[model samples]
Target: MNEGDERALKVAVLGCGAVGSQVVRLLTEQRDDLAARVGAPVELVGVAVRRLDAPREVDVPAGLLTTDATELVSRGDVDVVVEVIGGIEPARSLILAALDNGASVVTANKALLAEDGPTLFEAAAKAERDLYYEAAVAGAIPILRPLRESLAGDRVTRVLGIVNGTTNFILDRMDTSGAGFSEALEEAQELGYAEADPTADVEGFDAAAKAAILASLAFHSRVTASDVHREGISEVTAADVASARDMGSVVKLLAICELRPGPDGQDQVAARVHPAMIPRSHPLASVHEAYNAVFVESEAAGQLMFYGPGAGGAPTASAVLGDLVTVARNRLDGTRGAGESAYADRAVQPMGETRTRYHVAIDVDDRAGVLAAVANAFADHDVSIQTVRQEGRGADAQLVVVSHSAPDSALSATVEQLREMDIVREVTSVMRVEGDAE
Candidate 1:
């Protein structure tokens, strides 16, 4: 091999799936540009797959393809290992081994990172290697680096984002087409935005994983996937969309992470992923289809947003390549990148401690004083209604009240009081309203 190729940083791609193929394709196609940028050529040393006989997309040599992922990761020739085989199993194990064997790592597996980030990060730190995963969250949007580097000196108070393209596409279609949940999901699957078994995407699991990562980075604390309270878009109906539209708003799945004061005068972080009502004028409401946007509210920077394609082979590959370049530079310099933040390891506040506005739809007796009674219930709990709308007069009337920012305890008490009222039939929906006009 030539001196340029010999000294080039060698990368092994584990899992030649949809995302892995793109990584290989880019490394080959953009070799000249990447080499110029890095001041040295980067080479793809090997490609690992579950099946050696699987049809491939890239023009990689068959000899370079192998089913031995463990062997590939531990090879001494591999300088950096990119793990795209998502999940908690062999991906996690292989990543740990890659770092143990003195190789840097770039991963697109959000699930693995969300679950075992602390362990893996510690492993890399011990090895004095870089473990970068910008592709793991908000694909191609360049979120993690900004949170880790650009905004590292600033204090971020809140991060509310539309991080999942699949659910965002489904919700956007439902709002515009007035389609029910199932119909919108069906269309999303057909259009390749969602998988056939889309439980992970539609059920808010995917967004929750991203939320955990964002929360941890923004707060400089450790937040796990289990710490987030997740609610899916499965229950959103056409009626819900119409209700939001009537109020000049739209429905979107939001991953929200905020650091607020607790009772002890200390900072407490709250992380959650759920479907909520966002005003039509909000920036995120305009984000449609398989795109991602993260709105950050910082104490110093005020309001800022990062938006782009959140997923896809090329978009994801772009993020991986960026990390690869940075890590390669750090490796050559004999220095490691920034490690996890152990500063301000604040408590993850319970869901009940998270205070926000609420929109409640209740089926009430269409009588004259029913509205007054409902309003009194909210007043009893010290929750003030920002707006109230009553529809369908007579015995089948429904009372919809949107409350201003209030304590979660008070909101829960108001709901309980409404449930106890004899005139109230059922609570149709009770959703949090975020991104209110400031």
Candidate 2:
């Protein structure tokens, strides 16, 4: 190979769908800028697609498209592999093959990363190659890089945010328009904010994947999707939204990861994705529509917020390109970026042991001793009540109780016991309270 060819970094993209096409566009349109930034030419060597004739959003040059992803990444001349083909099997195998073949990788596969990130990270480490995946967590918001790079020196205590755009859009609609969960979800589908199935986003699988990624980065530990406690927002009713409004709050599906003490007094990781009521004044509560925001709390940094378009073909592609430039530059420099940081390797706390506040609304008999009985149920589980409000009189009576921070298991037991109580007419709504106290 000539000196010019040796200096030029060859990039193989292993997908030609939404994100893949946009990546191709940026690589072609910003070729000059990318070359300058990398201190060398960046070339799109090949694009691996499932179908050659399939229509694409961007025009991939002739002779660059291929159906064989393995062959494309295995080519000796390929210096960088960008894997936009999301999923576990093929994407994982292709990425591993690329790293083994001595090429750095940039991927936007959150599910793969969340499920089996350590495998990819180990592969890259063994090959002495960079594995940059800033696009995996929050799209163009740049949260992963900050957690991996910028905030490396700071001790992050907690990571909380609305990381899923589909669920956020649905919840935002429900909050703003008093739409039921089904109605809001329908509107989201109509607007293209949600998929036809919508199971992944609405059922909290998407956010759980993202939560695992965030927990791994923030705590410098290995966290997987199974370790994350997930709860979908499909059960959120219009009455729940109205209840939140009455309390000066709004409901949002949140990805929360925290570092807390374990039973042995050692630090443990607690990561959960669920719908919760947050004060309107909170940063995450203000995140509306399809936008994403992450609020970070650390020992030295105090508080930091990263916000932007959480997902979209173009926005995600922007992150992929950013990582591409970084990996390409590293290739030219004969250096590698930071691999996975699992030095802490903390234990993942059980969902039952995790601590948080709860808002429980219960319909009860409008007779004497109802308040005492409810308070006793909470006390029986060692759950402390922070505030209580009673509405209506006689048969129309309802008791809304918000609790102080307590173990989730204890709060859950209290709610269960309340359900069995004869004095309790019905458990109207139960939601975890976050951000602020009443």
What's the lDDT for all of these models?
Answer: 0.90, 0.93
In model 1, what lDDT does residue 277 have? Answer: 94
Clashing pairs in 1: none
TM-score of each: 0.97, 0.98
In model 1, what lDDT does residue 204 have?
94
Worst 10 residues of 2 by lDDT: 1-10
Q: Model 2 over residues 316-430: C-alpha lDDT tens digits?
A: 9999999998988778777788889999989999999999999999999999999999999999999999989999998999999999999999999999999999999999999
**Candidate 1 ranges with C-alpha deviation above 4 Å:** 1-6
C-alpha RMSD for every candidate:
2.0, 1.6
User: What TM-score would candidate 2 get against the native?
Assistant: 0.98
Give residue 339's lDDT in candidate 1 (0 to 100). 88
Model 2, residue 294: distance off in Å is 0.5
**CA deviation > 4 Å runs, candidate 2:** 1-6
| TM-score, predicted candidate 1 vs. hidden true structure | 0.97
